[model samples]
Target chain A: MQLLNNRSAQLRAPGKRVSRARVAVVRAAKTADGPRVAIVGVTGAVGQEFLTVLKERNFPYSDLKLLASARSAGQKQEFEGHTYTVQELTENSFKDVDIALFSAGGSISKKFGPVAVKDGAIVVDNSSAYRMTEGVPLVIPEVNPEAMSHIKVGKGGAIIANPNCSTIIALMAVTPLHRLATVKRMCVSTYQAASGAGAAAMEELRQQTRDVLDGKPAQPKIFPLQYAFNLFSHNSGMDVELGYNEEEMKLVKETRKIWSFPSVRITATCVRVPVMRAHAESINLEFENDISEAAALEALAAFPGVSIINDRQNNRFPTPLDATTKDNVFVGRVRRDISRDDNKGLDLFVCGDQIKKGAALNAVQIAELLLK
Target chain B: MQLLNNRSAQLRAPGKRVSRARVAVVRAAKTADGPRVAIVGVTGAVGQEFLTVLKERNFPYSDLKLLASARSAGQKQEFEGHTYTVQELTENSFKDVDIALFSAGGSISKKFGPVAVKDGAIVVDNSSAYRMTEGVPLVIPEVNPEAMSHIKVGKGGAIIANPNCSTIIALMAVTPLHRLATVKRMCVSTYQAASGAGAAAMEELRQQTRDVLDGKPAQPKIFPLQYAFNLFSHNSGMDVELGYNEEEMKLVKETRKIWSFPSVRITATCVRVPVMRAHAESINLEFENDISEAAALEALAAFPGVSIINDRQNNRFPTPLDATTKDNVFVGRVRRDISRDDNKGLDLFVCGDQIKKGAALNAVQIAELLLK
Candidate 1:
């Protein structure tokens, strides 16, 4: 635990060498009965979190391999009490690997995902490269584990895609209510964090904030605008014709694909806030049938991986920090939409750790489903 | 201009004494024909901004009076090349004042606003004290200036209330579209700034941020949660039964009142971000009649005190920083909501200076309206 704290501190100081003193010495017991797991892009933010989640969840594995881009290939990573050098990702990197977790950017996943699948590894991809692909099963374990039930470890080569972080976080809170009454439409506005952009962006936020406090002008490098004390529309590619940025479109398209309800109308506005890792979303839902706030709270309480913070008396609801480093998505402000006369509409505020439930943990849960 | 920048810098440093060097030298060339102006709660954020906005717009005033709570009384405030002591607000303060701008808390406004009006001074309130009061106009200058046309300078006393900051920012962008097509339903998610809470809260945010960056615990005094690198639901009183905060309900009720269309459905989720002064909103509108994106843009472009920043090719949209200290509200992301098949739904991102258009400047505009 102390070593983990030291390592976390070191992460904030970019360009610093990983000293031996900060290495986590806690080791997982290897079992021959378990599968051989390989983690692609082990040097990135979500990649490092994959290791933490796997260890915390005690995901059983007989052997583990870490792979990254050539630039990070020679770097040493300490995981499960073992120091392993990250290898350059290539077609041969997945040889004899039973389960592979991929979280590199889209292009890297696009180039290497098929190679791993063909090599008999079940690829659990955490990129946009395969999420919208027709044959790929975009899975959010709590919402739809059945989407990828056909793929299993040691069964055959296959690919299961993880939905976007924002989509995964939103559905975690909404899907439970959605189950009670079919959703006719959804409108989501996101207060996203720096982590969604990656480790470097988070560092930039910290450094820029420091500079600004010191009375120096904030230098923007990762984002086009000053991010120290400001928020802006998501820095995603724009769909000029549609007038929706790529991040907003992802929420629209991915929700339908995940819900398997193609006709469910959805719109989203994605903005990046100055928070560190967690993401908060304000969601408005119109249901096809009457779904009272009481019924929605009951459904959310029963749903696994969901927690309620709706204490209206105290005005204490979920903030980004409430969900930081937490597994379950935190939901609050559950109320019937007063705008509509019928009780078919609801409003919710949800927060979840962008790196945990939004990315690494959700992907790990998918891997767990594969075992079942 | 240099003096204004110096004052701005000094304002960020709370508990510090105001140096004479920061006082403005540019006088407003007061005319005897102009109205007598009194600013209530002159030590607060919006009250201080009232001075700046009045000077920038060159609103003619024969004489100026600064009033605040007893705690701030006797403090010297320099404006228009002269230093005057802030006086304690009292019944006698509005003896000869033609326009009294009230921005104190609701209690202060409730107590003194009537006193000012009864003293024959026209009160332009920047609190919820009289917003929903019968016959008291809830005015957003760009949206409903004529709501208070019955009252004029040197006429019998009347009170006009400024809508809440969030409502002011949202309606500025939505009213233009609503004019083109009557709005049936509206959903708003606000990214509010610290200024909405007042000057002390803004100071708390800055202090908390400095402490957080220095590795010390963020001691949240003005807010219940950490304000640095974090966002939270608005800290206003919540309605336990309705499950809406006072801030959110204000948006819903004030919009209906300002539009004079009591049946117009509106719901809002208000969250305070770490921004300094500007507020941003993601607004989704459902109109009674079809309104195309082009027509909506045309209406917005022709509207007064509105600016368009919809640069899709660059993914540029209205950001809080972009509207900071600006007189006009910035609107962007003008697109038809693909969620609805018809052209009746539209999504917009809007930002406005919470102190300027949302509070002080809007109140000033109301004072200007009385002249005509």
Candidate 2:
């Protein structure tokens, strides 16, 4: 499988259409009827990342359908050397598809997710639509694959929800430690990238930064605040009564659901930074039982899709650029909290591409588990 | 006093130098015999900010001395219609000085701060050199002017230390609430700006961002990592045994000294963001006594040099740019922490200019108290 990690890979011209021999590989698998794949919201950022992740993972697929809003219909997109015209997403779009990857916003997912499931196409939803819906499974494959084990691509269709990007990125690093220490409370402060707000926000950052650098005023269209070299609270709607924004609450709520620990206490401050791709979080955790730093490091090192970059002597912990376009969630600055006398408190920093593992790749991994 | 808020104020090309008639304001009465002033490390970011702040606040000075390292010694600086040649700093430089504003790095401050005091100059040091030193008062003028009341201009010389930037900014908003509710524990995560590192680091952020936008590799010179479109753990030397960096520990240690509360439990994680001149911090406080959100807001609004910008309905909160050259520390996202059911935990976000309110303006305010 070819791993695509940057703009160069995304913009690389197709090296001729896939040869007949390459297509034959799909014929050897039981699920290789490639569960006719359909990507809802194919014109969006995570929509684009879904295709990249699918191609990179070499997921067996036969026919592919690109679906988006009516406005984006008929747009030409090249995937794996084949040019496909986007079809406007509708109730009937998933009729014969065996698997569907939905990256449209929550309303679109809430409306179409069930429609797609009714058509027998297992849905791996990237939005938060059915995530907390009773009996609907929210899965981060590396963290909780068993959550959706009953749903198989060929046998039946069901909507498997993806956790929030920050939640997914954070749990990827902290869950391993949790398994060992039994985390009692968690506090997180996020340095989120502009991409988490979508492609337009990312472009706004680029344009605004360009203007700021050229000694011009920053005209913030996507965000109401200056975003070129400044940051603010997450733009999500605030729960005025609770004083927590939707993003912060998502981190708190989603972690509990994904970990199946309803009693866990969590607090988060989500702020939008001007970084282009990955998100970085500073997390401090209190455990029910004392866990040494070495034990936590050992656990994190063994966790799948979790990479450790804790270099203390050189002071090189994870940075967003190090995790940009990368698959693994990079964890660093791992150490015990000095404020706690008990060995139960620990702190760490995490960075992961919000588009990849946080959104697209996690949903794609869920699709893979459906095949298994 | 006129307050300058942006580059138009800082970068305004010098008009014709002021006439001799305009210079007589320094000859006015009171503290206007305006103790002769010496600005140490005048070529650096905070040092230059000291000059602007003094000019903006109408800080009275009879004669101004600009001092820097030998490399910057010959530079010409125009201040209040007078052009003064930068003088290479030496022990003898403070002989005629009544008040010295020091923003040179710690080593220089340690080496020269005492010398300036011995030479009968009251030194308002902006480095971390003597902040925690015994009998050397660490002050935030609004919060702890009493700590420096003993030192008066023209009476005797003394070294008064300015607290660390992050510590000063955090305490500006939190201390007011602490007075009302008695904070028991504080957990802070800072999004520090490039200017905290100095003028060269700010230039690096600009240059590297341009390079990254042009598809060129970010050439990291001032910072070891690519700071453009990214964030990293604070670069201060890490205490390997405690796993806390110098920046984080300074927040813990300095809070104790400035608040004069020895037993308060505090922890901090400091990360450097891409913003140019201001630092933003997300702070969570657990109080010993319950404090209502309205009460906290009331306290903050009534505090000097603390402004509230939390408009929950408009989703408008403080950003780094909003506080860039502003004297006030902007506080927002003020609310009770939902994760804590006890009404004792409150969360807020703060932004203050790293060079202005955090360092230079703070030092100048301390100097003002010295005059009183």
Q: Lowest-lDDT window of 10 residues in candidate 1 chain B?
A: B20-29
State the lDDT of candidate 1 residue by residue for A241-299, as single tens digits. 99988888899889999999999999999999999999999999999999988899999
Best by DockQ: 1
List, residue by residue over B153-188, the lDDT tens digit for candidate 1: 888788899999999999999999999999999999
Off by over 4 Å in 2: A1-32, B1-32
Residue range A123-178, candidate 2, lDDT tens digits: 88988888888788999998889988888877767888999999999999999999
Taking chain A of model 1 alone, its TM-score versus the true chain A equals 0.92
TM-score of chain B of each: 0.92, 0.93
Model 2 lDDT at residue A154: 73
> The CA-based lDDT of model 2 is what?
0.87
Q: In candidate 2 chain A, where is summed lDDT lowest over 10 consecutive residues?
A: A1-10
Q: Give the DockQ-based CAPRI class for model 1.
A: medium
